[model samples]
Target: MSQLATRPPLILTLRMDSQSQEFFNAFRKTYFPPERNYLDAHLTLFHHLNDNDQTLATVKSIAQPAFTLKTTGMKFLGAGVAFAIESKELHNIRKELAIQLHEQLIPQDKQGYRPHITIQNKVSPEAAKQLLNELQSTFQPITITARGLDLWQYLGGPWKHHAYHALGPAPG
Candidate 1:
């Protein structure tokens, strides 16, 4: 198999809503300049699909009509910013889906499993501390409903807004 065929695919996700999109865009703008805003707005559900056909088939097999996921609070990962999922159902569902993928399709990595959405990167230790302080003072809990799933490709290039492709509804 070719190298690209050997590598796994990525599942990009988000709480498909105007507020979520706007928030992501604003957050990116604040942290990353236009030139650096290569990564499109998304919350990743899982990564490293072993086989695209098998992965897609599995997803399709478990497909649901539709479902909503909500984000409830703000979290700080050093200098990285993220919102937490409030709904137990949403959290459980995402975890279950990831576990299923890991067990059935992809092998686990050394990193183990931890779910998060990265809002920004590139912070000095001092800057991270400052940002954390600011987050404590200024961050407010926000909620958003997720509605879609995307199958994305990392084209061996700088992160760009066009790297994602909609893969239809998420399997609820």
Candidate 2:
């Protein structure tokens, strides 16, 4: 196999700006101090596309204009913590994009469609519940706009500082 063939293809994602960044930073410090080096703020679209070139082309063709995303609630996934979006439109957009990418360019697993931005990973179940309780007590809704989509790669480290490339604007 060729070099390109050996590597997994990933879809682009959009990143959060300064204010959101600051909020996440503070949240991390308060609730997840151990998760250091986490840098870029983003939401993932697709990963491991079978054909990257085709996928990119297809993505560009269907991408929508940028829009706002409001953070409405919080949840925990095993040891992971994340904030949820208030807008159903945002959720639907993500799901639809994922579906489009999977159906057209590559096949995706059915169970991979949960919409969330992970804050931390690898915690005990009890700790996760405690963290959730703490978050619920201190929770405040944050609204943010989605400017674009980005393509990220796994650089073999903690998720906080993963290297990423912006693909393009999202389709409306």
Candidate 3:
């Protein structure tokens, strides 16, 4: 069998700037259940994409420059919380990629995209609600930079690094 055919599915995530990554990752580590935290803080673009040449080519063809996305507020996930992101440029980039790799997208990826970085998950509802209320009390909007897209090979509980498709230089 071909390597691509036997390989695990790919997950695409927005690559945040170092500062932003650290900030979010800190929150993730402090709040997310250690037993269930298999990955760092991330904003997923696609939950699952086929691991194949076509999917790789489509990601490589994206020519957008690094851009800033605003963190509008917090999203209550019943059992967790995430910071909501807002960016027209990010949306457009995903739309273009979606068109190009429509055939490789799973049903979840085919749905509308609501960009977010999950900081905490897999906790009880009460714990989640208390954290949500605490965080929301002093929440202020912040802008974060998106530098690229990272592809990962899902390994059941953890992910293996696959590749990174860097975006062009940020516009001044």
Question: Which model, 1 or 3, shows the larger TM-score?
Answer: 3
Point out where model 1 deviates above 4 Å: 2-8, 33-35, 64-70, 103-114, 157-172
Q: All candidates' TM-scores?
A: 0.70, 0.74, 0.96
Residue range 1-172, candidate 3, lDDT tens digits: 9877888999999998999999999999999999998899999999888888888888999989999999999999989999999999999999998999888788999998999999989889999999999999999988999999999999887999899999999988
The lDDT per prediction is 0.55, 0.60, 0.92
Q: How many backbone clashes does candidate 3 have?
A: 0
Q: Compute the lDDT of residue 86 as modeled in candidate 2.
A: 59
So what's the TM-score on candidate 1? Answer: 0.70
Residue 137 in model 1: lDDT: 81
Each candidate: how many clashes?
A: 3, 14, 0
Per-residue lDDT of candidate 1, residues 64-160 (tens digit): 3345555555566675665555555444555656656666444543244444556565566566566556766876666565654555555564422
User: Model 3 reaches what TM-score against the true structure?
Assistant: 0.96
* Residue 133 lDDT in candidate 1: 69
Q: Kindly list the per-residue Cα lDDT of model 2 for residues 98-172, writing each as its tens digit.
A: 666656444453454555566655777788788888887988887776654555454454332223333246565
Stretches off by above 4 angstroms in model 3 are none
Best candidate, TM-score? 3
